[model samples]
Target: MAPVPKSMSGILIDAPGGADVLQWKTDLPVPQLQDGEILVRNEFIGINYIDTYFRTGLYKAPFPLVTGKEAGGVVVASSSPEFKEGDRVGYISDHAYAELTALPAAKAVLLPAGITTEQAAASLLQGLTALTFVREAAGIKQELGVSEGPWTLVHAAAGGTGSQLVQILSVMGAKIIGTAGSPEKCELARKNGAQWVIDSRSEDVAARVKEITSGRGVDVIFDGVGKATFDLDLEIIARKGTLIVFGNASGPVDPVNLLRLSPKNIKLMRPVLLSYIVTKEEWRSYATELFDLIAAEKIKIAVFKTYPLSEVRQAHEDLEGRKSTGKLLLKV
Candidate 1:
């Protein structure tokens, strides 16, 4: 193995703001390993909406932050007994917008033989999110209870996490209704297994959803569009249904009335991916299942574009502008 470098190039943010805040620097120091941590030479870094939240101070962090949460790379140094110098890994951790990251072994999983580092980077965060949401958040299988699949709705269904949710829900036999901004994205959502696709931009979303479900409303609503769609979710969710609001693509949903949920006996959840996989055991279990699904081709990864580290500003612009579908990645 080659020796690790003393310095590397990465994106840094001095303070909260917009995409302009992401600064590329070539002299950033390679992270020094700590106990229970391993140093990774990142090959690809996953771009997520949460990164924007951190950058804009919506999700507060200290200034001069290295704001990224996930990446896939080869372990170059280890202070953890569970990892070695050449193992391939995908991890969720702070300070990932860099050529190298020192991440806790607890937040990472070993890559199986057939999966490439690129695929690991692409799927780990979003794939596990979809799996956990379906299996636990909505309790899809348990709710089936010997009946036909339940009616489920996914907002922004052609986006990274949304695509994963649609595919997993399809495999679990759920009848999926997906909403995307444009016809192309809506078609992509249908290709990912949405039984019906609504153009949220041009169509009456709530009406289409209600019409498609025969006015029963959907049994499960997976909304990542936050403030823009929360009211619509309330209007269309079925009696005793579950509403899982997981992202803030349109901005955070305002505080709930609680009374809103009472009328329909709705179950409301605002879950974060980190909370679902807190322990090593939990992380590995879901990650294993996620990788298995990918291996079986039950879930397909769609990478919209790969930006060079210096082009991260434009990547953020494109992502925030909603100009791209599927996942955006930064090549490290």
Candidate 2:
């Protein structure tokens, strides 16, 4: 087993702003473990758009902050009986932007057989988010009464979460109409299992959705683009359909008019990951399903790019610029 170091290198943001605030520290103290806590020497760090939000102050952070959400690594020390030295693991936490992270034993999952540290680091957080979005937020079971019965639409369909949504919907045999910014993205969405791809840049989303559904509209719409696509989603979403506004890559949505809900019986929801995966049991269940899908070769994780931990700014720039699709990882 590799020896644990007393100090580690990490990225720190003294205040929220752009990625410019992310500074690499050469001699940061390795976190001390409390009882039932495990310390990991991180090998791979997961870069998520949420990190951008925290950096930009869209999401508040107490600084100086180390703002990463997930990472994969090996346990170097543990005060927890549940783990020991050299256990391969992946963990989720808000303050994860470092070479070493201390996690409560309950918040970490041992990498199962046949799953890589890279896959665990990349998949655990986002994959479970996708599973929950499809199974719960979209309410696929309650909405789709028949096998292969429902039609679903996913905005930003070539995105990290959006692609996973398409894959999960395909597994359930649901017809999927996905929207993307360009033709290349449209093709990527199709490969991820979207039956129809809309170039939102060139196509009228509501008109195309109506044309595809023949005016009945879709059973569910996953709207991650926020204000830019909200009006279109409202107009084209089916009567009694659900619209899950899970993200805001464009910008935060405007105030909604509840009066519209009465006319169409539409349901609007904004589901967040932390609320659903709050409990260890809940975490375990979601992780189990996500891992099963991956282990069984049902969900294929796509990493578009990776950066050494030093280039976190570049990773953030690429993600925030809307320049890439699928997940981005950081080599810690």
Candidate that scores best on lDDT: 1
User: Over the stretch 7-43, how does candidate 1's per-residue lDDT look in tens digits?
Assistant: 9999999989989999999999888888899999999
Instruction: Find the candidate with the highest TM-score and give its number.
Output: 1
lDDT of 1 at 35: 89
Give stretches of model 1 more than 4 Å off: 142-147
Which regions of candidate 2 fall more than 4 Å away from where they truly are? 142-147
Error of 1 at 265 (Å): 0.8
Residue-level lDDT of model 2, residues 1-332, one tens digit each, is 76777889999998888878899897999999999999988898888877888888888868888889998889999998889998998888767788899989999988888888899888877787888887778766534422375889999999888888888888877889999999999999999989889999998888888999899998899887888888888888899999899887888899987997887899999998878888989988888888888989888999999899998888898999999899999998
TM-score, prediction 2: 0.96
Return the TM-score for candidate 1, rounded to 2 decimals.
0.97
For residue 116, give model 1's deviation from the true position in Å.
Answer: 0.7
